[model samples]
Target: MKKLYILGIMSVVCVFFGSCNDEWKEELHSQMISFKAPVGSNGVCDIYMRYQPDGTASYELPVIVSGTRDNGRNINVKIGVDNDTLYHLNTEKFAVGRKDLWYRQLPENFYTFPSEVCQIPAGENVQNYTLNFNLKGLDLNEKWVLPLNVEEDPSYVRNIRKGWCKALLGINLYNDYSGTYSTTLMNIYVDGTTNDPAIVDNRVTRVVDNNSIFFYAGSVWEEDENRSKYKVIVTFNEGELNKDGNMAGSLTIKQGDPTSGANIVPVGDCTYELIVQKHETKPYLERHITILRLEYKYTDFTSDPKNPIIYDVKGSMTMERQINTLIPDQDQAIQW
Candidate 1:
């Protein structure tokens, strides 16, 4: 009986050790690798790969090139099975070019190869891959490296426009009644220095009724005040015209705020109300009345310093046609 007990204990120890070995083997079968670029500059090339215990693998390749003062940047990336000869399996190409020198802008013109998957070699429990790339004339000396042992989460980076203000004003006549009317101009005030402060000022303007109604809008950076503001002014004119005509207006909108630096505040959603009054010179007429309500909404807002600040403004107008009892003949003239 004692000999049988000894044999049983030996068998239990063997089974426990075998189970631990199997777990170790499974852990060793999986592998991962991560890559990072040097400091003070964007990454020119980086690659990531993961190997599973089931002989499957995945990879992500990222490439970036530096832009120059005069020309654009180029990026190239390639990945392939790890062999003595370093044969490439796939490649991705992307480029970023400079569009405007005054804006100091670099726009991304290409992007490809988000991810890929493949199977490991048959009968071979281990798998490995190679990454090769060239960035903006810079040669990467590192040819191949083991993938990071930790799993990496998917990531994405993009550039979006922000901090822009757009405003629109439209007036629709209900009936065919011809009369002279003046346009109201908008005034913009901007505080703080910017790469192009004048660029912000030119965004606001008079869009409709160029001959009948005058529009004025501009931005200015005030160093002393340390604040940036945009203003739109609408001026209206009174005159006589042949009765029977309707007018509709529209215009292009652009950025009216500073792109960078301190005191750069984004213009939030806003709306303005305009009041129009009619009066006859022979009869005294004066009253403040609401004529139109203009609402502006900016959908895209970004903190990125490279993009321009632009907003979308939609305008709507409401007119009152009630006759004025105070003035005799026709009706009272419009008042402010």
Candidate 2:
């Protein structure tokens, strides 16, 4: 009886194995695949770039996929931005988690996505798409969002569980910081209202480092309009200072400025000349004009340049991007 039972169990096991092989072959023809954005990164995030002469900035967005691809079968998947759900979702995901903050709402003319469609070739597991934007059109004053989602994969299955279906691009454009900047010179003979601030609007021949400027006071920067007698220019090492969410940093007060006619007058104990506050807030995509806070005092002509007293400077600045045909930030891609 035991021998007979063993033979019967073996026969059933063989039959089950045969059945699975046949079914797996059929299932392979219609395997379900899911698409996902790269891990640890916003499926969509904006990359800020320096203003270009051509007036445009560009970037690449990548989409990752999973699951088995059919043999000899190339599948076409559709990808687009789902505007319908974006409004319901919060855009400041990066800021909300740490500190409550909102991204800028950019204008419609600021960006251009090359294609609404992405393809998953025969066996390829990844695809990259290009996004082009107009830097000149970007207003640092406003915040923006570009949400990208994977809508359909006729050859695969939609992954609702992993929730990797979308990537939100947070746009933040940057200015060269090369133009003339108005200052608010403080802490001098008139700590708050004495010396009028001068321009730290340093410009360089090299287009790349134009955003940086020199802070120097040869004579006196009077709030009533003061000028330095000798050429005053200073150079220093830049420091990283990020508070809240701004592209802010500090430059150490160094001992020289070669480009200017003369070296910037050095203070007795002050090591740092300026603490730049070029933060981007809502409405401003980048810094149109930044405020410079001086942390030192120099003898000035205001009270007598030869016998100038200690003073600190701080000032307000303003710059506007006048490409005014503004509109609500729109979804760049539509579901297929």
Candidate 3:
């Protein structure tokens, strides 16, 4: 009985083996012989590569992949570069935990691949694949520098000096001699030059208003021993006063010698006044006056020829009441 039982078991095992072999052969004949990744998967996802006897090959590449996985499902990935001269390959080794994958294309000197395969669980959605590569054309690493300088122009300097003089000391000096007055005085000098003791008393009149003011004044210019220092003065006088005791007028004093074409130096400390009055019978009248004074001591004028003689001038004016107004102060005043 034991021998029969053993024989029966052997017979059953042989039939089972025979049936399995036949089924396997039939399935292989019908099914394609290749390795393939499931539809819609990427990274280390399974891919099928088939090589036929006719020297033809087929590959099923994944469409999408992830860098990481939540479950134990992870994919292994590898890359290779083949060129005429060289062949390089690398593999991804570690499992990615997140989905965000960054692949940058760098200058291609060699090929590299992920050392590990990416994996996704069954029934998982497929992901898109990202491919990156770089090509080398030229080298880049250069720098440049520039040198610059800034300075004031000489023409600008001269113009600035002239503008400053015009803004500060260039003014008209005037005096009226129609009233009972005599000897109106004026002075001129360089704006910043110091004065010497020898030429202090030089004074002259520059203008004479013979019409309304009826005054005569003349100007005098004298250079010091060194010819670098100069003194100029102007004076005016009124011949007589009118019957109404309201006899006055004005004059204008300007730089530059009328006879010698010499430019008068600008006086720094100068004051000017304007007076206005209304006559009962005549129209309103206005007057302007200027005065300049200087105090100088000897100094080396040869140091800079551009430097000129300096002086201070003071100017004032008095207007008579011609309108017969009640307020005396309001009737006649300086405009200036």
Q: Which candidate has the top score in lDDT? A: 2
lDDT of 3 by residue, 7-116 (tens): 99999999999999777544232111111222122222222111122222222123222213322233222222212111111124223431112111223331122222
Give me the displacement of residue 44 in model 2, in angstroms. 6.4
Q: Which residue runs does candidate 1 get wrong by more than 4 Å? A: 28-106, 110-336
Candidate 2 has an lDDT of 0.45
TM-score of each: 0.18, 0.46, 0.18
lDDT of 2 by residue, 1-336 (tens): 999999999999999999997776664433443443343353335444555656677766665555444433455556666574444444435433422234444556777767666665766667677777876644332336666667774556655565566666666444433233433233234435555444444222112222433323522322222232322333224534456443444433432334433333434333233232333443323223333333443334344546544444333232332211133321221000
Instruction: Report the number of clashing residue pairs per model.
Output: 41, 40, 51
The clash number for model 2 is: 40
| Candidate closest to the true structure, highest TM-score | 2
Clashes of 1: 41
Candidate 3: 10-residue stretch with minimal lDDT: 140-149
Which parts of model 3 are misplaced by more than 4 Å?
1-245, 256-262, 265-306, 315-336
Instruction: Give residue 60's lDDT in candidate 1 (0 to 100).
Output: 29
The weakest ten consecutive residues by lDDT in model 1 span 163-172
